[model samples]
Target: MNTQSYMTSYEILVYTGDKRGAGTDSNVSITLFSKNGKQTGKIPLKNSNNKDPFERKQVDKFCVKGDYIGELTKLHIEHDNSGRSSGWFLDKIVVTDIFDPKTQYVATCNQWLAKDEGDRKISRDLTLHKQQTTTQKSNYYKVTVYTGNKSGAGTNSDVSLTLYGNLGEAGPMKLANQEDNFEPGKKDEFTIECQNVGELNQIFIAHNNKGLSAAWFLDSIVIEDLYAMHTYQFPCHRWLAKNEDDGKIARFLVPQSSTTETPQIRKHNQYKVTVFTGNKSGAGTDADVFITLFGNQGQTGQIKLDNEKDNFETGQKDEFIVECPAVGEINKILIEHNNKGLSSGWFLDRILIEDTQGHRTYEFPCNRWLAKDEDDKQIARYLVPRPKVKNNQYKVTVFTGNKSGAGTDADVFITLFGNQGQTGQIKLDNEKDNFETGQKDEFIVECPAVGEINKILIEHNNKGLSS
Candidate 1:
């Protein structure tokens, strides 16, 4: 509950125990204060009058709540034994909303000791071991340390450090040497390259007095491959977007112009629509464009395209990302292009869809349907979280033919069933069922939460089907 809100509640738990001798009774009290140490409230737990060792008493349970924002609060528990011994036991203390746990700060130590306006310190404590024979691999591992002691001469006593590792089965390894050290008031760094005895998981570091004091510590027990993980370049923060215009001019759309050239597509039951106009020709025209997509059965979602509404211009190619305020299964999208007898045409290239985490949309790897839809599956579906953004829906696009693909059209759709009703289905027609050569289809579904969409099923119901 330690939040930025101007008004918040504070909760705490106080335990009290044994404040008497082996034969007398005791008493205890609890007090609460504001972050500035101002007394706010107090409560008495118990008072004893007996004098037996087994007669010593304790406070059962104490709870308190207070409004504390932009300040620190304190709790003081006291025990009084006017006629008995003088030792009190505090079992536990709990504080609520003390600090924001989600704050992103480079941790110098796994357990932060302190951080504030002028000074900060991080530390680690670990143990390393060497081999029993000299025949081992290069008896050493590289230790990299990062510090933020910039603009101040760095000192070691204030930064005590120690290294303990296994030697050739004789004794623990201690400061073989200080590879590099800097004075106080300056940015600091150090590297202790040790003999590789398999791996060194722990490297203990402390500041002040060489290694005597435990004031500052830094430890990184986890070994990570800093170079192997794949890094992705987000084309732009606005990959998937929502606009109320024709559903075209997308990150991946067909290059074309004109409503007569290609029909603009819309979701079956919702406000969502799609306009396809990003052809490889690089001409940002949409006069001859048409769009198509499978509609969910309930028809509660919306879809649209903006081939021209965005900052699209001629002779320039642009990539876009889909944005959704919710999460859902998006399985169909289609678009078409014709001159509408205008004698002018549009063209298109590739299309893709990915999740919020940037992982393209493909069902879970272990999904059973993966094998069945192998021929019509796409590797470019990425998930998005809903309700947090404006357009609370997913996005889709059409590739290949307006309503077809290599062997089957790539339209998408979904099915829904109300909480108390039976199941239903939605199908992406045109390209989804079957499309002309070289066209793509895209669509989206609003999946803000489980309450938004009861169920979703996608299919390519081509015109040739006999339902």
Candidate 2:
């Protein structure tokens, strides 16, 4: 009946090992932690009876008073390692709230907790454990990839496909096996385990542009979710190549159902895109150029800027038309080129996109290099409209686990992806000791607006402990 603080009581049931030397006369103590709040100080365990607790093959029970801890999650238990039989072999501990009998937490630690035994650790931090009575069912799907039958339509590059749905996206699933896959007028089939993204909305297909003939003319893709009993089709009649139709390697395609409900697929808008190559020496490239527009309504995927005459010369202004759904207002655009041709370096100056249907224009200024060995060594560039849009500062909060050794000193970074574009890997560092065990760290990242973030990538270098 110790009265330091007593809002609730927890019944601690400790199980000692059945071995001959498992008995211990050492003083045992425990600290409890719960989801709602913390419990003040640790509680000593003893009995008024003539017999000592912690006997071999015995269940020692004790009642401790502490603060109201709702639904226990973890606890700290240790012995002073003082008595003659201090080298005890502990089995497990089960804690229950006396007020709320239904709330129980079990921690299994079948190891030696003595300085002279095991890892030579005298104390143990035990987390909540539960027996798994059932297995998690995995979602499996049948993926079919169809290649177009055009002149040199086959690609020798490695292809990756990702499926997106109302549930989420799955894969960068490899689409290659043996037998020289992705041949002209051919189809490749494979089975994959992906989370059942209910009612797929789109598919993102791409290639690394490697190998000898890395140009791919993808015709269509069909996926059957065996668990959900649903089928989704993504039709693509274009080329995913660095030098082909779009000079782009990545693409996002919506399912047939989405296009069917888009009022009418024929009721699309055409956007006139004007590209100006930098006037400097070797500023122009023969590489295929592509663009994707993002606005208030939505975004259009990569569109190729193709023309009859030789385009993208020194200080050349090339114009092309792109047709898609009406993007309400102009926001930004992603411009890039395939590192093709003998001289594949190109410096882009600026871009102007005119919405023919909406009668609005958006200008994105680049004035940078998109070469493999030049400035930034990036072939792709994301530019906002003219007038130089200011950067967006996003407050990002990260929660580190509360378990043992859940903190790290490694440099952490995060990347955010949305319907518009993605942000680069921004470091998550501050003046404080961040990422401590069970710590909530907040960081402000200043970057362009990645409109409507869809995915966030979090990672850290493995230089530190328990990253």
Off by over 4 Å in 2: 1-137, 258-467
Model 1 ranges off by over 4 Å: 1-31, 35-56, 59-64, 69-405, 412-467
Q: CA lDDT of each candidate?
A: 0.30, 0.75
TM value for model 2: 0.33
lDDT of 2 by residue, 1-467 (tens): 65745475566789988877887888988898876666547888775122778888788876566686566778888999998889888899988654444446799889888888889887898997633322222467888889999988998888888775533346778876676789999988978886555456556788998988889898888888664445777777888887776477877675555335553222346677888989999898888776767777676655557777799898889888665555677777878776889778899998877665443455778999999999889998889886533468999999999988888998887877788665555778778999999999999877657689999988887765555
- Per-residue lDDT of 1-467 in model 1, one digit per residue for the tens? 64643433232333333433222234545454544545534445432222222232332322233343333344455445444343433433443332221111111111211221113321122111111222332222223333223333232433322222221111123322444443322223333333332212122232323432212222111222111111111111111112213222122112111224453322211223212224334334333332232323211112223344442233344433333222234445443332223223333332323333322232211111111123233312222212132223445454553333344533344544335321223344433443445655565544322234466554664523331
Candidate that would win on TM-score? 2
- Model 1 scores worst on lDDT over the 10 consecutive residues at 232-241
Overall local distance difference test of candidate 2: 0.75
TM-score of each: 0.21, 0.33
